[model samples]
Target: MTDHVDVLIVGAGLSGIGAAYRLQTMSKGKTYAILESRAAAGGTWDLFRYPGIRSDSDMYTLSFPFKPWTHANAIADGEDIRRYIHDTAHENKIDQHIRFGHRVTRASWSSDDAQWTVDASTDDGPVTITASFLYLCSGYYNYDQGYTPEFPGLEDFEGEVVHPQFWTDDVDYEGKEVVVIGSGATAVTLIPSMAGSTKHVTMLQRSPTYITALPQGDPIAGFLRKILPGGIAHRLTRIKNAAIAIGFYVFSQRFPQQASKFLIGRARKSLPADFDPKHLTPTYNPWDQRLCIVPNGDLFRTLRSGKASIVTDRIARFTKTGIDLESGEHLDADLVVTATGLQVVAFGQIAVEVDGRKIDSHETYVYKGMMFSGIPNFAWCVGYTNASWTLRADLTSQYVCRLINHMDARGYAFGMPDPAGASGDAAPLLNLQSGYVQRVAGILPQQGSSSPWTIRQNWFLDAWDNRRADLDEAMVWTRQREVARAG
Candidate 1:
């Protein structure tokens, strides 16, 4: 049977669930349904099972506003995060609204009907649904495809080859020399977690990534939560974290050397005096890509325990014995993990159209970094790099709700970003070399060259412009739609 609803949320991940929670509470007399591709919720948490998979950022900003993240460490583990997502959904009564295993394959917009026709593949087979608003929360991380490098002579390797995104529990790596390629967050996480279980883990990366250590627990936050109400505590905690990030960011802009010194200097002091900076210190500026956070120095602890080793070398090829390095050294391994990274897709690879014209997202610019330049009745939530992802995601959700509520109040069926009649001199979305961002550079959302939506990775600024702003005069609203009706 087919279904119809006021809103159809795609993916039951944090962004999707966050949208549902806000809609349930704020949207009066609105019927909504959440469609999840997997049988379970907690999108990333439920899926990724690589060793040491967990949140690099703190839980305070990660958790919803209505929920209290009581984890002792600011950073939490995979299970802890999975449980948190499940708990948030349950406590908020959003679990019933979620129809799991509904993998959305195609979504086509019908302007005549002012709705979206979503085609999904579920266990029950193909089914179609329609909704007034379609919100995509499926993150940039591709669920079906993880990055796997094509190594020459890989077939000759006598070891099990795996990608972290597609890990299975059956594989045994005990006493095996494990080589985890790439030095992204995933690789860093896996190194420490597998050190004890495996013979040794060699993190093979061509270049270095900045790694920083954060306290497991927040000292002032611990004190406030005990005395203050949970909501108040969360607000204070979020504010404190935002301020600290801003200070570092401002310094990074004003005095690059001082900022680098403060950051790398700490790293230098923490590790052994003889530890090579060539391996530990990266060449790029801070926040160039994303910094991997090691909780309470757990990674360092694992290193001190004598089970893990970091190797800086490019892979030459795979052999019957193991991976051959460019330096002519062979690291024999029982298994190889290509913890390379993810392939990001804007709007979860769902097709969008306007006025019978299929939208080539690669062709449009990001308006406000949430809505596309010409898309209507939709807002996609991608994750963050510097601040907690949920921080920006929550803001986007709140703003969307307010925008929808305003539209509904005025009897409007849609709101679209009309960048059609522009100044004609706008640049592409991103000019960086982020593995995923670079792929969708021209097609991704374009923010203003300098401010608000230009993709600034600041939490306080995001919270203010989105969360605290007045719903009036947002530039993209249904007032134009209502006025056009009179004409």
Candidate 2:
């Protein structure tokens, strides 16, 4: 049992850390604690240890606003990111308040007290802590499970089965055939990284996703980093990246067919003449699912080097040697890596309960994608999947600070959206077509079925609302002790 705190932020990933940084900087004398399930911080970065792992988004936009990114590599690697997070926390003195290895299992809200009762499992066992506000900085990515499709006769297979999420350093693919499944970012990253170590590598994807290539390091940023201050360079790069992201987001949303055609055209050029673009191309819409980024055409380079190749087919079953695709093709391998996809769980499978009743996440709409409808005294950070995640996270953090001030100024104990306002004609949030989004559909806060909550996935809206302006009407504020009445 622990005494109450002003704020309790779960997870230590980009979003979680961002919330802490903002809260500390914005709130005066506010007590906050960051509970990380892992032994150390660096949420996703710390958890994933696959080779060639790095940010898909540019560092300029990914880095925190207060802590400027000066790394020459426009897209930074995992270790570099972990270091940056650590440095940011330490420099800001946020490290002192974090509880490592404290995995939060359930958070229950007390309508009477207008506070949250958080039950967490630490190394010592379960302990309950109370807080006025619970900020779910836990990113949409699931922590407990990695994507591992049931390969038929997986037990019969003698080869090692692996997942990108739980990749370890010791898995030796030296001179062995490796098959990496799934075409998303994880598989794209795996093929290039394991090509050299393995005898030959095959990137097996059921269908193609939009894959655009960028260099490992930005030449322009590299030059500017040497001449200009790190902060200045960070600002320049962030803005430039944001502009590009904005253009794409708008283009895709406004002109779906046109944008898809343009993407197809680019794919044709980047890929080989023999490569089929139809199955490789998506059908629904662009920006509906996240795009994959490969550094310096890493997958292309691997293909060019004759060390790797891409196979598009449905994985029908698993045999002792490898996977059997529904197309009657079998991929023989000594090792198999399922980069299939992620499972987006609501609140990371960490339940949210109000009074004795468990909160129905699906019934709620997202207000600014940070706070939920009918969920009180709680704020969570969900970033742009279309762009750099940090861009949205940073904005969310700033928004929270404003919310705290709003609560303080007016004297409201708790704030959850008036369920009355959520009823009638409002639709379930999100327009994503990915399986992960579907798994947790209705549970996630509605962004309006459009963007910025119901629909805004662009980075510009995030920056404008978070760093550039005052808190908007979408947010609900609460006082220190008042609780929202849940129906």
Clashes of each: 6, 19
Give residue 319's lDDT in candidate 2 (0 to 100): 88
lDDT string for model 1 (1-487, tens) is 7789998888898888899888977786788888888989999999998777888778887877678777787888888999889988898888999998888888887666677888888877998999988888888667999767578999899889998889988878899999989888888888888888898888888888777788878988899999999889988887788677666666666786676667777766666777677777777777666767888777767766668877898889999878889999989888899888787666787767666788877666565667766677887886556667888888778778887887777767777765451344565554445565666565565555543336666777666677555544334544445555544
lDDT of all the models against the reference?
Answer: 0.78, 0.78
lDDT for model 2, on a 0 to 1 scale?
Answer: 0.78
Tens digits of per-residue lDDT for model 2 on 1-487?
A: 6778999999887777788878877887888898988888898899889988889888888889778887778778899999999888888888888898888899998767778999999889997889988998878778778756666688878899888888888888999999988878888887888888899999887777887777778777767778999878777878888888768878989999998888778656776787666645876688878877777777776776789888878878888888888989988989988888877777767888987888777767777767776788787777777888888788778778877777778877767765534433565455578776776665665545433345466777556656654454544655444443432
Query: For candidate 1, what is the total of clashing residue pairs?
Result: 6
Q: How many backbone clashes does candidate 2 have?
A: 19
Model 1's alpha-carbon lDDT is: 0.78
